[model samples]
Target: MSNPKGKTYIVEHLDPELGQWSELEYVAIAKETQVAQGTFLLSSLPEAFNVPPALSQVPAFKPERRGVEELYANDKSRVCLLDPSASSDLGPDDGDKFDAFLFGGILGDDPPRDRTSELRKKGFEGRRLGPKQMTTDTAVRVTRMVVEDKIPLDEISYLDFPELKFNDHESTQMPFRYVKGQDGKPMMPEGMIQLIEKDADKSIDDLF
Candidate 1:
């Protein structure tokens, strides 16, 4: 994919302890979803980007997963870490300074203490995306919006998101509604109920 500013890559630092089947599944989904969103999701492992044959059609779908730390070491000047506690925020014209944006893929509630300290010591400037923590995928998307649209970091507010206006007849609204009835019964659509049941069954099967 062509990143007008330069080649944009998202690096995911996988946790060694997160070797669960479901956790690995989430990693695969995250990688594929980012590829679908026109960004490459790279890893430190050589075999991490071995996507299925169907997804191999897109050049951006294939992630470069070899010696990511070395790449950062080679281009230490361009390294930036998306940490909320950082002193600096990325500016509009800041996209061109680096080819890749790195994000840690820790699903835990708190940031990876050791990795964050290491990145800081290596001269990777911590850049804040928002006041609150964000999911790894959300961080990647927000980074794209900043880099691609050249939006100033300070002007970008999560609380004041872009409003979507649609004509009454345009049918842009979703048909699904999830709520609770007066009797405390679930007021979900039939399709949603089926989906929930299916997922619950799948979870139970996976537990065995």
Candidate 2:
């Protein structure tokens, strides 16, 4: 597909365990083209973009409680987008309006969750977590980006994922960038870019 009109913002959820490096999940395409020029539902982009639903929501193979755990533990993180024409819910001529890409990542145990209190008490406000903790932060960041039209770094609190023994003494911060596509191009909307850059600069100044 042709690139969208705005700057691309790539958001990744890195899993330190399983040797899975950073995976590109969500790509917010530019908003100027005829295909992306509307208030589309977050659920509608798979068809227009010729991508897959798996691109948005990764499926679980097992039905039991640990099915989720087993899936991720196996390191099968790829998702497939099915043909919309085959769905009874969608018509063949439907243009893939919301087929814009969406993605994320999962953090493995590293810095250790139990040590979070130590970090927080030591003036480390953002660091450490369980799966729920990390997911919550991710959801909040994505929502803020969509609603406020900008990415707020401060909104993201850090959690101690496991770190290498040699790098144990290093400090980790939550790093963020505009979402990008598989082609290494940004998929951010035009208006979103201005807001992200503006808010990011403000956040940096506040830190000082």
Top candidate (lDDT)? 1
C-alpha RMSD of each candidate structure in angstroms: 10.2, 19.2
Return the TM-score for each candidate structure. 0.56, 0.18
- Which pairs of residues collide in model 1? none
81 Cα displacement, candidate 2 (Å): 16
Worst 10 residues of 1 by lDDT: 171-180
The true-versus-predicted C-alpha distance at residue 179 of model 1, in Å, is 22
Point to the candidate with the largest TM-score.
1
Runs off by more than 4 Å, candidate 1: 1-6, 16-39, 46-58, 107-115, 154-208
